[model samples]
Target: MPPLPPVKASDSRAARLVLLVTAIGLISLNLRPALTSPGPLLSEIMREFGIDTALAGGVTGISLICLGVFGAAAPRLARRFGPERVILALLVVLAAGIALRGTGSFGALIGGMILAGLGIGVIQVLLPGIVKRDFARHAGTMTGLYTMNLCLGAAIGAGLAIPLEQTLGSWRLSLAAWALPALAAAIIWLPQAFVRQSPAPRAARPGRLWRDPLAWAVTCFMGLQSCLAYMMIGLMPLILEQRGDDSARAGLITAIAIAPQALTALAVPHFAARMRNQSAVAIVSIAVSAIGFLGLLFAPPSTALLFAVIEGLGLGATIGIAILFIVLRAPDSHVATDLSGMSQSVGYIIAALGPIVAGLLRDAGGNWVLPAAFFLAVASLNAVAGWYAGRDAHVLQDPES
Candidate 1:
């Protein structure tokens, strides 16, 4: 069949597109706050509740596992309903989860985290396909735009949590404050659910994805980079605190370190898209992140800002490239969402292990040395995966070529 005629920019259509893009940015802004906001308040939560590192790590781990499980389920949901509607419902759920998490009960917190993760999981899988479908010609640029917002949202959450607590006289209120953004994003996104969409093709059955090598490469890269991202989210503040910074400063430092990622996330994907292959950029990003990790481990307290800048740039680049691969490697939007679900489901499951394992090592060894060394080794493996994933071929093609 000939493709549908290109969507011309009529007044209403143009307004819709503008709203959609604004909604996308708003949703992207909501994504990271739920995940990163908790990191800053963890010490107070632990101290008040007598929770230990292993248990604290479990909260992050469980949320990641939910992210994986729900991510895998998203394509099916999107195909059965529609991506826009699914996203709208998830946003409400996310807002509710964020609010419920601050109710002062441990069980409530866990339930809230899982609920929030489930919401985030579906959105993560769907956004790439939506971008691919709507902005096919501008996939890389749009991806970078939304992703930059994701980093900015993360930085804001991490940086502000402590200050919010200071002003509000309770960490619970600080955690609940994130719900405001989610609700506002939902209000902006509400218009999308009402727009009629053409029926999507039935999603492929899940089993075949397990057999695809490029899918595996994409999955590995997603998982490995996520390991670094989640590890930092769950532990960076603690790492800083252990080194002599107070909780508030630690959170702020973590925010400053993560801020540079927004710049690289914006620039790298646009430049990388012009290349014949992305392998070099991929490996270099990992190398840069590895160096940053090394500096954070050994550098004096005074150099924290320098280390943060390096680490953020590297992480931002790697993550931006990872998202780009879902679009770049797929043959179409259907394939892109499928590959996204496959990668995120398995990738997040693998990432779920990172924080808990590091916590265990820290508990056992009583120092950060072993955990840092272990993460370096994982980063090395991530470089190898990125190299293969960067090859100039589609997922359906024989990657060996």
Candidate 2:
């Protein structure tokens, strides 16, 4: 009959915070696998379904389209049910989508991807606002963490798809394995939905985000960079295979390009947050990314590994900076939700075009050169938009607003 010593309040609070962050990170780990896993397996899936590259690209494009469409719905759902509960529910949906793809039919496969995108898009829109709401002081660092995990998940999917296929003897089984992690994250996040959150401060209404030039700049930066990012994810492995690498080797190379994303994804936001404005960081990231893309396109196939790593570093930094702008520029969680929804909604829709266009270009020219040139133009525009969006000004600062 002994009583345990009472736990300290500060200690308990710290433990809970750590648990919340872990939950958030775990949830972020589910965001990209569905999008990237199918990349390495695209050729196999296309063969099984008797589809062309354009149709293959449509799978990624479909998800991005759903991502855009659902992104706009996230804030509304959050306002009604709270972000935590909505996220938890959507994780189940995501898991179901992942498993549905395992049915080994093209209809189920495409249907599953659309469901997964619905889960991913809303969860993504809501997370920035939660970070801003709960971890406002460390928004940049936390955003870096979020994005780092997101990229890491993508690398895992791209890197392991072929091996998993070999081990399991079917690509369907490999894709279905991701469902386990989605469910695990949902279990870890169970407690968060019940914890009451601090109320967000009432913020002055900015004019419609669509009407704000600063908001548009942020959207453009996010969209264009995401366009480039998705383009590479959708096409890189295929490009390598066409250049003569085997499926496994191509997947490994694609994974190598994505793995380094974690480093810059963590570093860029931390660095940008300390500066007066993020323009230098944003513009520099864009330049490095463009250089890497061009190198991969024009250099000997022998150089793919080196260029892949370079591309990852720059791409990771760009994504981190894009998300950081959303948290930093918005004055409150409410505004952050609205801005996040707007930026990602429009941005991902624009992003969807990248894969489809690249596919069409390849079909027309019988090579990747046209797609490469198109992406170069996209990167050039991303640089300009990032500079404007990176300025140290709030989206609501206009007097008329």
| Tens-digit lDDT string for candidate 1 (1-401) | 99988666696777888999999999998998888888878888889889988778777888899989999989989988888889999999999999998898989889999999999999989999988888899888998998898899989988999999999889888988899999999899888888756466456545666788878998999999989888877888888888898998899988997889999999998889878799899999998988887788789988977888899999899889999988898878888899999999889998988888888888889988888987898898998899899988887665333
lDDT of candidates 1 onward, in order: 0.87, 0.90
Off-target runs (Cα >4 Å) in candidate 2 are 1-3, 197-207
What does candidate 2's lDDT look like per residue over 268-294, in tens digits? Answer: 998889888999899999989888888
Worst 10 residues of 2 by lDDT: 198-207
TM-score: model 2 vs. ground truth = 0.97
Native-vs-model 1 lDDT? 0.87
Q: What value does the lDDT take at residue 246 in candidate 1?
A: 93
Instruction: TM-score each candidate.
Output: 0.95, 0.97
Q: What's the CA error at residue 387 for candidate 2, in Å?
A: 0.6
Error of 1 at 166 (Å): 1.1
